[model samples]
Target: MVWIIGFLVVALFVYFAMLGWRGFGLIATGEVAGIGLGVGVILLPIIGVWLVYSTLRAGIEHQQLARAIKDDGRELDISHLPIRPSGRLERDAADELFAQVKAEWEADPEDWRNTYRIARAYDYAGDRTRAREMMKRAVGQYHHVQGR
Candidate 1:
């Protein structure tokens, strides 16, 4: 009967109410659900802190690279983009800049673009083993994004 089914549903929800959720308590469609609100309370601050750290790290590395780039050394000509994405850096007038970029990227694996550049740097410097490792990390990240 409809009444029996309804009662069973309610009972089922009550049995599983302790899993960081209130079960079926907030069932409104098209509106922000209670579970969503609960998740937002926990996830937002963690993500915010992560983003802040990433931004600061990137800024610091950018400044260091810019200073290095201006000095006299073997260098690679790059575009005017203030923040260069990771790639294989060339041996031009700015090789020092490329070396700095490789160091920063090695210290932080979260920068996917820089990972590729660092790998290329090592590859060019005849460190094939390190280059392969960095390339593997980059490939792993790429696969993760694709899966998502």
Candidate 2:
């Protein structure tokens, strides 16, 4: 799995580099419209690389936090939650779980563990935006606590 992912990432970087090369070719044409298009094309690869780097970094950080929490026996356990046919937690159950986790988080908002639990609860409750926000917060707190 790691090898496959690495291969895919390399392939994607190659594709982006090709796009950047084409953009420079367009710029070499020395036409006003071509220059405008070339600049836009050039920005695409730059932005793509930045986004990919940031997303991968965040995912790695999240996994590290999860591992730490699990090692400490503090990871959220949702095995008892009712699940719907689609494999998601039942709405009411998810809401209840969220409420519990939110209270924990409120009690110690600065603690990465509480923030991580709230993030998981938000995710299970189908609030993706809030989940992502909380997860980012948790990651930041974890980093700070670790002096990273």
Candidate 3:
């Protein structure tokens, strides 16, 4: 549990740290602050890291989005597609997001919405079998969704 918390904190720190770098970049611009150059120098490396991470993440998302589009045979904005909100998807859930979700449903699987998001995370991370099981459970539980 402690390890999990620690991991979450570290992940959160990485995200905000990147934002801080970006903010610093905008604030320290020469035209904006005159001292922007000086401040930017101090902040550029951090922001550069942020930019690199962002670029890479975007590329991965694009790749997944393409896969999703191909699988669905329709245009879809992958970024607009919601995930489980773990933010862990930054690295772990790329491939599955690209491959699985866009595909058609199988066999009218059981209701498992409670687990659906988790299954998506697993799917995004490329754990299709586990995701499928979760989906089956979610499908089985479908009646509950309408308070049935």
Candidate 4:
């Protein structure tokens, strides 16, 4: 299901990119307006491509982590996790949740699952930088243990 959506998004981006490129070719090359349009035409596609690549990469990484967690046979209790209508956790709730998760992570710094949980807590807290850092750590540990 997600793959279908991803494919549709990529197709849309590609279609728009082709149109932008065609528009660039129709503009007079030497005109200032043409230069601006050309830049926009080039940049928009590049940004779109980057977006697609990053999103796919992140999804793949997350899926791999989920598989690892499942295979580990340990359950993570998220019943008390607070989420808002926007699909994000409330700041105060996230902070409290993060504190508990952080303690567990500190207790076993080498556990990839714990690290991943911490990353998720940070993510819920709207701290993407910390979340990414924790995810990197989690991935590294998983890879190391898996001999990958």
**Which one is best on TM-score?**
2
Winner by TM-score between candidate 3 and candidate 2: 2
In the range 27-99, model 2's lDDT, one tens digit per residue, is: 9999999999999999999999998899889888889989999999988888998899999999999999898
* lDDT leader: 2
lDDT, ranked from best to worst: 2, 4, 1, 3
Alpha-carbon TM-score of each model against the true structure:
0.34, 0.96, 0.27, 0.71
Q: Put down candidate 3 lDDT per residue, 1-148, tens digits, no spaces.
A: 6578568657756776776666666666646664565465556556666776765554454445345445655532357544566653544346555445434334233423234445565666767798666655554464355465
Those runs of model 4 whose alpha carbons end farther than 4 Å from true positions after fitting are 26-28, 80-96, 124-129
Which of the predicted structures, 2 or 4, would earn the higher lDDT when compared with the native? 2
Per-residue error for 21 in candidate 4, Å, reads 1.9
| 10 residues in a row with least lDDT, candidate 4 | 73-82
- In model 2, residue pairs whose N, Cα or C atoms come closer than 3 Å (at least 3 residues apart or on different chains), thus clashing, are none
**Better by lDDT, candidate 3 or 1:** 1
Instruction: Judge candidate 2 at residue 51 and give its lDDT.
Output: 86
Model 4 lDDT at residue 17: 76
Off by over 4 Å in 2: none
Q: What local distance difference test score does each model get?
A: 0.55, 0.92, 0.54, 0.82
Model 3 compared with the native: what TM-score?
0.27
In TM-score terms, candidate 2 sits at 0.96
